[model samples]
Target: MRIAVALFEDAEELDWAGPWEVLAAWARQFPEDDVEVVTVASHDGPVTCAKGLRVLPDHTWETLGAVDVLVYPGGVGTRRELADPVVLDRLRTLHAEETLLASVCTGSLVFAAAGLLDGRPATTWWGLVERLGELGDGVDVRPDARFVDDGDVVTAAGVSAGIDMALHLVARLHSVERAREVRRYIQYDPEPPV
Candidate 1:
């Protein structure tokens, strides 16, 4: 399984890191499964996160391979990146490839900007629900869901919610038992935010 986690200038750190940890742990725990996780960006270079963590990409968008799971995380950069034709074009291309796409926080904004969520129910980083209304009419926009699974697309509410989303994926892909084992390994026992 080839998973590509897209990054950008000012990308939310946890949006990528939280899920990255889960998937990476999966590959490490189950070495028999070939899960190659790679970080990608629009260009091949260093990207500094909104939190100040600088990361280097394994590949650029143009050279990416067939991604089984394509994750686009959000941050302050999204408000601007969502408007870039190149970014939206790449996202639309990835969506057309029939690959599973996921997002965290305002990451859905990118999907919305790409017109993927135009008529589909979706959610985002809470407060913006009213503002993200362009995603079609009466879209549930369940801001309360820790994460919503709408077939090939999965969306998490906020930053930390991504952890739960990743765990759910583990349960879905392998087994609930495996997911539990992962949660236990990570000390993320079943508990919601306080």
Candidate 2:
């Protein structure tokens, strides 16, 4: 599986990193899975993220070539990118060619903007549910789901929830046992004190 994590200006780091960690660990521990992960940007070179994190992309949309899965991360950037023709066109093209498309946090808004979530049950950062619903007329927005799996597209709510979605993807693609192993390897037993 070749997974491309789409990065853009102001993208939430964990939205992409959480999944990257899970899939990358699975690939490392179980080499037979053959999971290849890379970060791609709409343009070449560096992107400054929402919280001031800078990332140099591995490839650009024009260079990423034949990705099996594409993970779009959400952040403040999505607010502006919701109507960007370049981003929307690229996503539409990828949706046609990619086997699966997943989004973390507000990334679902981008999918919604591209018409991928029309009549599809999906989730996003809780606060954005109303806005997302507005983007897709028939969108069945799930404000509480950690993530919604609608066959070809999967959408995750808020930041840390992405880890759950990534683990789910592991189980979906491999086995429950494999997902457990990856989770254990990451020591991801979350016991939040809030």
Candidate 3:
């Protein structure tokens, strides 16, 4: 599975890192699966994360290949990304290609803005569900589900939820046992905080 993780200026670090860590572990555990996880940004160079951390993209949006899955992470930049036509257009393009879409936290706003969440059940950070209603009717905002699976599109709530979503993706793509093994390897079985 070729997964393209999208990053832009001010993207939340954990939203991107949580999934990346889980998936990177999955790749390490099952090297034969050939699951590719590459970072892509609006531009072709380094991008600063919401925490002021710099991340270099593996490819530019225009050069990304056939993506089986697209992951968008939200950050302090989301309030501004709401008006970014480039990000919205990229979301449109990825959705049009029928790739599995996933988002963490306010990243759902990008999908909502791109019209991809229209009539699709989804979620985001606890308090931001109201803003997503503008995208479509019957969004079925879920504040409790760590990750909501609505077929091709899966949305996770908050930052750590991305880890759960990644394991979910592993189960979906491979097997439940494999997902369990990966979770065990990462010691993700214990929930320390509510």
Candidate 4:
């Protein structure tokens, strides 16, 4: 299975990186599974993240082949994507091809703008629940959910919530036991001190 994490300028670092860590670990630990994780962007050039982290994508949209899954991360850049017809068309094409679509934070908003979330259950950054609802008519926005798994389309709330969503993807694609193993491998035992 080939999983592509879509990157763009100003994308939140953790939104994509957290999931990348989990998925990359799975690919590394279980090569027999034939899982490949890669990052792709609209262009071949380096992408500057929201916090100024530079990333060179593995492939450009034009160069990428068939993908089993597509992970779209959110950030200030998503606002621009919402208005870009090229981005929206590619997303629609991927969905039509039955690729599993996952979004973090405001990434769902881009999905909404692309008409992918219409009449579907989805969520986004907590502060943007109302905005998501406004973006798509009949979009069932879940404000309290860490992530909403609506079968092919999974939407994660906020930034760090993407890690939880990624773990869920591991369980869904492989097994709960495998997800547990990956969590242990990453030592992701979160206990917020706040």
Q: Tell me which of candidates 1 and 4 scores higher on TM-score.
A: 4
Output the number of the TM-score-best candidate. Answer: 4
Per-residue CA lDDT of model 2 for 1-194, tens digit only, reads 89888899999989988998998898899999888888899888789999998999999878888988888999999988888988888888888876699999999999999999999999999888999999986999999899999999999999999999999999998899999999999999999999
Q: Candidate 1 — what's its lDDT?
A: 0.83
Candidate 4 local lDDT, 84-145, one digit each (tens): 99999999999999999999999999999999999999999998899999988799999999
**CA lDDT of every candidate:** 0.83, 0.92, 0.86, 0.96
Which 10 residues in a row give candidate 3 its minimum summed lDDT? 134-143
Q: What is the lDDT of residue 71 in candidate 1?
A: 77
RMSD of 1: 1.8
Model 2, C-alpha of 33: deviation from truth (Å): 1.0
Q: State the number of backbone clashes in model 2.
A: 1
How many steric overlaps are in each model, in order?
Answer: 0, 1, 0, 0
The superposed Cα distance between candidate 2 and the true structure at residue 137, in angstroms, equals 2.2
What is the TM-score (0 to 1) of candidate 1? 0.92
**Residue 88 miss distance in model 3 (angstroms):** 1.6
Task: Provide TM-scores for the models.
Answer: 0.92, 0.97, 0.93, 0.99
* Residue range 1-194, candidate 3, lDDT tens digits: 89888888999999998888788788888898888889988787789998899999999877887989988898888878878897788778777888999999999888888787788789899878888776656677777778888998899998989989989999998899989988988888755777
